[model samples]
Target: MSFEYYYITVVSLVIFIVALVIAIIMNSRYYKVIREYLVQARGAEAKGQAMSGEVEVLACPRCGYSTTIPFRVGDYVGKVVGETCPKDGERLVVVAIYSLRPTEYQGS
Candidate 1:
């Protein structure tokens, strides 16, 4: 082949190699960012589960009898629970819902 053709071929091969290297570097960076984000998201989810829980305070309207129980799904303040009070056979109502974590309202 002519010297011109050989030079052109060499330049083209070099350009292709440079483009391939750039693509690999960019892909590696993208994957690293995605991996870090996923790790952070998982850690946050686990921390949330470990840190907070809810409890329901049930009270009898008639007798002023109150008790605490683990909060169930769909339980809300003012909701009537299926269980009745031991004192007066009155239907118990959810008087309050609070988290297990200590907050500003809870004094030291």
Candidate 2:
């Protein structure tokens, strides 16, 4: 084989190998993201079941009053919520967040 032909063949093989590696790396990342989405979706479905949901604990820093409510998407600890304290009339702040299962919640 001519030296020119051999060198071109080697270079083309190297380029193909590099492209294959890059594609594999990108596909692995895509699959990772999909796996994470599926896990989150399953968690959301569990939380949507009867008496199972996430809750946020809110407190009034001024009067030390506290209450629990259903969790909202954007809620975070130390966030000031729009609801006023029933006892103190002050804005409530989120103090904690947690999930409740069917056996844990006792609704009246």
lDDT of 1 at 27: 100
Candidate 1 residue-wise lDDT, 27-84, digit = tens: 9999999999998898577546544677678999999999777668998899999989
User: How does model 1 score by TM-score?
Assistant: 0.46
TM-score for each predicted model, relative to the true structure: 0.46, 0.47
Displacement of residue 47 (Cα, Å) in model 1 is 2.2
Predicted structure 1: lDDT: 0.85
Question: lDDT of all the models against the reference?
Answer: 0.85, 0.86
> How much lDDT does candidate 2 score?
0.86
Error of 1 at 27 (Å): 1.2
Instruction: At residue 96, give the lDDT of candidate 1.
Output: 94
lDDT of 2 by residue, 39-59 (tens): 878756644652357788889
- Looking at candidate 1, what is the lDDT of residue 101? 70
